[model samples]
Target: MTDASIPSDGKWIPQAMSVKYLAKAKTALRAVASGEKVDWDTSGEKTVPVEVFDEDGQRVFTAEITMNVKLN
Candidate 1:
């Protein structure tokens, strides 16, 4: 991931980016879901909030990204 700044406001935002960036994001997600070790640059945070969206452009759920994320 690049040095993109996450918005401080708690709002769901969509970002426009290159296909390469999308691919990289997907790879990172896949790695995390597939039990691969992920080193998150949280800057000393314990958990990060991640919202998952569905195909209908709706948020299905939110996840807490942490070091002890259950692999699998």
Candidate 2:
């Protein structure tokens, strides 16, 4: 997560968001051994929780974003 930047027009421009996954298993080891050249399978969608806080450290809003996930 990153802080938003305000432009001259008084609009907040937030940084690009992304998702990352860490794997530690046989499948992961195989993928690594293959130099990550294996086909990926769609696992499913996941909901990521987000929270917005004000300058006073108070929770102002909360939200969730759905993202598609893949597995090797």
Candidate 3:
């Protein structure tokens, strides 16, 4: 049986050169969703409130990145 290849963990790349950027930093429906264009700065920081959920669907983490160095 051939083993399926998993996706990458994510690495920095040029914003224009990039085709997509996954926003898996949140889980709540009211939080960041897929295919959502967020505002970022030169430091590549997007000010968004995130709420993470556990395996049991319980809110676990709430992160507010002071400086998210994700330069597309």
Scored by TM-score, the top model is 2
The alpha-carbon lDDT assigned to residue 11 of candidate 2 equals 24
Compared with the true structure, the alpha-carbon lDDT of candidate 3 equals 0.35
TM-score of model 1 (CA atoms): 0.31
TM-score against native, each model: 0.31, 0.39, 0.31
- Measured on C-alpha atoms, candidate 2 has an lDDT of 0.33
List model 1 lDDT by residue over 1-72, tens digit each: 212232232222223321112111222222112212333332332343455444444444445443321211
Our model 1 lands, by Cα RMSD against the true structure, at 13.8
Superposed model 1: Cα runs more than 4 Å off: 1-45, 68-72
| Pick by lDDT: 1 or 3, better one | 3
Clashes of 3: 2
User: Where does candidate 2 stray beyond 4 Å?
Assistant: 1-42
User: So what's the TM-score on candidate 2?
Assistant: 0.39
Across 8-63, the per-residue lDDT of candidate 2 in tens digits comes to 23322222344333322222121111112212223444444555444445444455
**Ten residues in sequence with the least summed lDDT for candidate 1:** 17-26
